[model samples]
Target chain A: MSSSGITPITKSVTPIPASATVVEAARLIEAEQSTLPVVDEAGRVLGVVDSASLLKALVPRYLEQLSHTGFIRQDPAGLLRHALQAAQQPVCDVVQTLPEYLQEGASEAHAAELFLHTGVLAIPVVDADGGLVGVVRRVDLVVALATD
Target chain B: MAELLAVGVFVLAIALIATERLHRTVVALTGGAFVILIGLIEQEPAIAAVDWAVLGLLAGMMILVWGAQQTGIFTWLAVAVGRASGGRPAMLVLGLTGSTALLSAFLDNVTTVLLVVPVTLVLADTLDIDAAPLVVAEVIASNIGGAATLIGDPPNIIIGSAANLGFVDFLVHVGPPAVLGYAAAMTWLYVRHGRQLVPEKERLEALASLDPTAGLGPRRDVVIVLACTGLTILGFFVHGLFHLEPATVAMSGAALFLLVGRPDVETALEGIEWTTLFFFGGLFVMVGALEANGTLERVAEALRDVTGGNRTAEVLGIAWTAAIASGLVDNIPFTAAMVPVVRDLSAEGSDVTWWSLSLGACYGGNLTLIGASANLVAAGALNRANRPLSFVSFMKYGIPATMISMAIGSLWLLLLLAVE
Candidate 1:
């Protein structure tokens, strides 16, 4: 069985637009799934956004400079205000542009390889033209392997 | 031809080390091997030149410090000082600087700074202040403090071993000047940067909330390590009376700790900085090659001509020249090269010039970020914590600190010479 057999790309899977705000993307991910594909106007897959990416986007840029040092707790009121301000940024600004994706015609073995290498729970499946096709999740790969 | 080749290689090694484009140990070891390969020095002499006392002292002290670190005693002591300051930023800085200087006088400056700077940074964060000034102050203080004792700085260790000076001799001669220089440096730091470290209300609250005693390790380990360190220091005092070397005292302490503490010997040994040990080994051989040839004698002759047998001129000249040279290069290698030259300048029993060289070389390290191993290690720790201390920024503080400290050192030396 190839990746096409395990892809969950029915008509209900709607890709988020690049122009959407981070809150909009987050709401969509919350409503549908943890992972959402970000597509440009021409239906080309631009990147992927997930709950983890959204949380990362809400963090102040300066905090990245604190390499290896653990996070310092801020006042809750200030942290909420900062996070709310970050929620208005464009999804494209916070999306993981280099996310791992699988081609629709790829095999289940290839899907397993990508999952192991990237350590991601789910990977977006794209067409040959790089259009959003579907997603292959870890659970889907596990079912496919079990049946094989 | 062999002498020329050896000198060329030595120069190249120093150039590489100054440029910092490569690791210093690699360059030093390569230069040492090249000198031997070209027949400037043979195998046995090179082996004999390694200064095993300095290496043994370094290794043993490293083991002792490493074991003590596992007990978290250094952090506890620093935090206790911070608490005593009552969250006042200036007092905290003064206390930390003073503590670092005192600890550095007995310990390796690099290890002393390594243990102290991190705690200082945490304290600075609690105070919600920039740590750059405080960290830089500690770096300078550590170098100065190390100058006061025979085993404090590597150059002092080399000087003590080479000149056969005892621990008490260094304490009596160099200790007073080091204390005066420390006072001058701390005064300058407060005058220049004290106002910038004022703690905000929220920062003061945060500082008050910190539990200084929370991180102190097991009580048994603390007691054992503290006892070991105390006895080791005491041993340094009486080692001369017993006709024992400092290395013997240090290694015995280290061995006793290892036996009692029962820390994994393999893991504890791994903490020893073998690279630094090897660097010392290689540098000694390279300097040995220079001595094997007549190159050191030529340098000495040139210096003698310049001084014209004027004792005052010779004393001041050696001190100031060493300060400037140490600022530009690693003081260890500079001290290594100057040791022979200083010997040639003075008679066997006269140790005035040796003290001058030690004071200048030790204090000269405060001139630049790259001047000493301690400064570089502190800077590296700062960089790792994402508080990047730029070289130019450090020089703004370093240049004045060096000038004031070196001036005090010179005056002290001159006064000592006059009295004698």
Candidate 2:
């Protein structure tokens, strides 16, 4: 839909295993940019893990229902210490539904729309057979749009 | 032909909803439309079938309560109750759930659970205690408390409006049993979780150190919302004296809040539960077509024949049957379908028939995890937090507590028969 073609970054980003724990996913997310494609041993894309998904598993789930968390202390009784089991949870459990992704040969306009809707820093780009091709970084997509 | 068309569509809608295959609103609207399109009910009559009083009451309360919660009053209330529990594990759980019930008696149960469940999860998480028992307890308590007043639950609103009953009328008839039901459910919860929820010294320290008034603020806004809420409850109490419907009282309460709070009209309108309102409208039209075509009377006649015209069997049959059906389906649409049937069954002017139906539908909703809207919302919240509550786990708690509560309701109905 756009004049500029999307430059999907296939080489730079790394994918994590589907069975990785939240802490392992968190470690990978911190090492790379936010979202890392999640794949099976055969390299089929099962899902993706990003900062948001990791934090979602760590924080109290009901905070989204309230406008304010002012009523309680942050570390009320060593909150993170209590999250040991939560940290050990497989990343797939925290993955909301499945990952929304961009298909290969998609336009910059299509990539931009996916970013806007998903609010993720990077989106996994998949092929017609649903194999992980690459991830389109939001920053790179925006830069291409500016120059095109 | 007309009666068959109406009954067929209603049956299809119920099947689709229970199967959870399509959006319930879509199923209801489709059912409503099919009857009219096939000429089973005329356009004018179908439009007339929607109960404006129930819609008005739901809309008004939705706006008033959602608007009031924006000021953080509910958060402050939750923390204050936690502080009041004084670090005792049982009291802390009971205080939170007890508050959920009491607030549910006055407001919508959905709103009550939405406001309180989050803080409860957090408090539970802070202590590293399992939140399932407490969350499920709150949900069950909400349905029981919702039976106490006219505006407390959706089923009651429909029954009260159709039966021409008032706030105090429901309180007098259903309130005592609801109190007993709540106590029975709470006692069951205590026995199940009280011994298991033993808190260590550190967890006790966390409970003792909470601040109650941390979220109380934006003083002017809080005062306005609370005042509006109080005036709304007062209006419900005195609505009978004014020769006004509960719908009018609720709308007045919403309007008063709007006038004082001065929030944007567009924003305020967005807060209303338009989907639920539309779902109810569709159900009414479908049920209305059934009424117009004489299907509801036939069902009532069948019931009467089955009971051999024994008054006690008739009432208890309706009460127990409602509990079982509501658990299988949902309470809202089930109650809508039964309204016309109950109307045909009741004596020309007595409200006793309405009472049995109300208690059955509301208490019976506690029978399963998916039995009520509140249950699903709580379970969903837990899911988001990485602790998915399985259906079997919830049913383990749901069935026993509901059985006890329903028994209490049955006992009360029997006593009413004895007294008469």
Candidate 3:
């Protein structure tokens, strides 16, 4: 277990560029995983753009009409226009800067601790130079624990 | 020397609070301790100086309000009132301000505005209007509402406890002026923004979709809170009959609610505003030190000389002075410092002055954005929602509303003086 490699999943995970459009970032996030690490030109992790953040950014502002007496009608076209406009912006504008992360060689226990404390679906792993290495998914940690 | 030390500590605490450099509770508690440490007040005297009744009453009511909050009653009421307005923006503004004022009169002003402002914002958004004007009006109204009752505003609570004035006494003396001021304020609000509040048909149709009861918790919990609050208010009215302080009534209600409602005790207690309670406790000791050292008497004499024995002039002077000072600084400490001065100013049958002080300090809070805790809290909520209120923007509404309310308050005081 100590010698187990994380490279299998790391190789398969695609890192998103900081300049990528919101649509591109969203597609990458949905097809690949919940979070796609946004990397700069030098492969340094700039931020992470997740599916939830994309949805939040793209969603049009609507009045929270919580009254049961009647329905507030919203224009579908307005919502679509808002979403399309948002999708044209670079993902960097909407990305959440990484707060903390695990190192590339961090133990499964350490990875689990980061996952638990940060409450993220996955922990971004960076190399000694702080370049994006891979992400340790919660599923990956669970699998590591089960196999051990 | 001891008197100088006490005054120094008191002034420093006020400075710290005004500057917002430290948490106010910290500044107050440290000042209270410094007074004891420097021998201005001894341990026994400091303990004696602390108004346990006011502290207990504040804590007890906080607990009851917390219990009610756990049941989401405030939100339910807000949504219900918003729906009742039928999404007419002007009517919605009126309803929200009225509800905020009424709630602030009984509950904490900060809490009242905190609950109501979000709902107001949502209503504003639904109606395709900016929330700033409605929120500003609510902030002003909350302070006016709070001034009307002994338990409504912290200043009134401190003044009530100091003067041994009953809840009924405050209602009788202060309530009328507060109501008048509220009406004047609402009129100004309407005149300023009534046209802007006209609702679009689409927004009105959208507001009908809101469910007032969406977040209201269990029926039994709501019932328990309502019953406890109702009994507590009733107890406040008749506590004098049982030789009980209002604090005892509040504490008993809280205990009963906890016992019957079966809420998680830890969760229930967590909502208590301990910082505010501590701040009050410390302020009482600081004021007591001033009282002990004859400083209050000297200040009162100075004020008496200034007024030249004219009762009407004296009342108006304190009201206007307090209003301006409260607008510039936090009112709780100003009221605490002035309570002793006002007490010293009162001769036989001089109850009218107390009403003036209450009116001045409470209404003056509407003069600036930072005038009252309620205003600050509402501004904070707005800022968090990305709709920050500027000092200039707030005062545009706040200053005129304050001037108008202060004018009405002064007139009412003179009328009371005339009647007397």
Candidate 4:
């Protein structure tokens, strides 16, 4: 078989349980090349929670108050307040979706497509059972291409 | 007056769906809700015309499909086919596409493709082709095959229920054309990718290494799922031919399958695409609004004015229009909305024109990338597996395959209508 210049890379994935604290999330993100890990607790992937998800999670009584006003604060202090509040929130509070999650795959092409479509710099590749396998990043592809 | 507003809303919904700007089911359900609201105010037949039987049929079929998938029966079949073909790249394509087409006629094409694509990718890696052509062939074949049965494609389901058409009706009217189209698809693949076939020994090795277990189930699971599918297909035909409602037959089949297998009810329910059902409901309401607003009547009148009530001219016009419209829009809504229009035209003179519209709408999806829900679902499944099927990539086969099918459909209709 002919090999292409694009070699599938595997490394630096960050995963946490949905119950992990914001400090834990921030540490994992900082440790793992600054990319968010897909979180799960008790073997179920709750969506990936990055800084954005963490911020969303911080807002108390999100579902209780359906008014749009809570979502529309623009002051820097208000944004900081939201972020700080989000930091206190549980990972489940800011989950991206339901039982069936949209995730990346182990294939190089799969990684590239996810990156292109979702605009994520890196994506968490999962096994068929939804366990974290590894991470594929833009830099990985770029490096592989450059060496080739 | 209010009807016009509903129609404008419906058109906007169609545009959003066709452009892939939102989930189709969402768009459809929104349209259905709007129509229901309008119906409450206008107090028209919109509510009466909603056809809960069709909705029930769709819901039951979806659950049946989910049961089959849960068992990994389809995945096992794809693996068996790949092994039987010895993984020769060309034979693999023929086997996978042929089998996919056959299954798609009874089961959902998306489920069929989802099962087949991963196996094909493994086979492709073994034979060492780009895998794109094989993927493309399977999708096109799935679409064509699904066109032959009343319950095969989504648009067919809508058309069948709306027209009170049955399984035998589809087989008599659309089956022959579908066969011809499948043959053409094989030929197309042969010309495009035949040279890429590898050695028999290498092919055998590739076949041996193939493991379809990525989503496989227990042996008991497989047996029960296959039995359920077999019964459902049988029920679809029996119910259709014997004057039983298709919805009744489908729901009965689903209840039996679930009861006998004793699968997880919660998982099966979750697996059902509720959003899609909502979308269908929405589309019904939107179409209802159009019907109430006189938009369909106005269009029918315009067509009558053009054709001078000549049935042949009208049939030809409706067929080609359906084909063209399907290329640019989601054929389910387009065909569903057109059902009454075609019916009125047929009533104005002869009933042959409705069949033409049915054929056009059903088969016309082969004309473009976004033509049918089956096409989109297949494309989405493959793309999820790391192989994105682009519009240009799909049209490479879709355009030609559609032309051939439409031509054959026209000729077959001419013969059928003329002889009888």
lDDT of every model, 2 decimals: 0.83, 0.83, 0.83, 0.70
- Residue lDDT tens for model 4, B229-268: 7887787777856788888888887888889889889988
Q: If ranked by DockQ, best first, what sequence of candidates would result?
A: 2, 3, 1, 4
Worst 10 residues of 1 chain A by lDDT: A67-76
Highest DockQ: which candidate? Answer: 2
TM-score of only chain B in every candidate structure = 0.97, 0.97, 0.97, 0.91
Candidate 2 lDDT over residue span B1-420, tens digit each = 778878889988988887879878888888888888888888999999999999999999998987778888887787788767766767876788888888899888888988888888777766667778888899999999999999999999999999899999999899999999998888888887876566566776676667766777688988998899899898898899999999998999999989989989899999997888888989998998999999989999999999997878888899989988888887888899899889888876566778889999998878887788888888988876657988888888888888998899888888877776
Could you give the candidate ranking by TM-score, starting with the highest? 2, 3, 1, 4
Model 1 RMSD in Å is 5.6
Going through the candidates in order, their DockQ values are 0.11, 0.47, 0.21, 0.02
Q: TM-scores of all models?
A: 0.80, 0.91, 0.90, 0.72
Flag clash pairs in model 4: A14-A37, A58-A85, A58-A86, B28-B282, B29-B279, B32-B282
Residue-level lDDT tens digits of model 3 in A1-148: 5455454434335788889999998777767788788888998887677877787678543223222212223333334555778898998888777567667666776676766876667667788888887887888778777875
DockQ computed for model 1 against the true two-chain complex using alpha carbons: 0.11
Would candidate 3 be rated incorrect, acceptable, medium or high by CAPRI criteria?
incorrect
What tens-digit string does per-residue lDDT give for candidate 4 at A30-74? 665555655666454555656655544543322222211221222
Clashing residue pairs, backbone N/CA/C < 3 A, model 3: A66-B210, A66-B211, A67-B209, A67-B210, A67-B211, A68-B210, A68-B211, A70-B208, A70-B209, A72-B206
- Scanning candidate 3 chain B in windows of ten residues, the lowest lDDT window is B121-130
Segments in model 2 whose C-alpha atoms lie over 4 Å from true places: A1-4, A7-11, A17-21, A42-48, A74-82, A89-107, A124-136, A141-148, B385-388, B415-420
Candidate 4 or 2, higher TM-score: 2
**lDDT (Cα, 0-100) at B115 in candidate 4:** 61
Question: What range of 10 consecutive residues in model 4 chain B has the weakest lDDT sum?
Answer: B198-207
Q: Candidate 1, which segments miss by more than 4 Å at Cα?
A: A1-148, B383-387
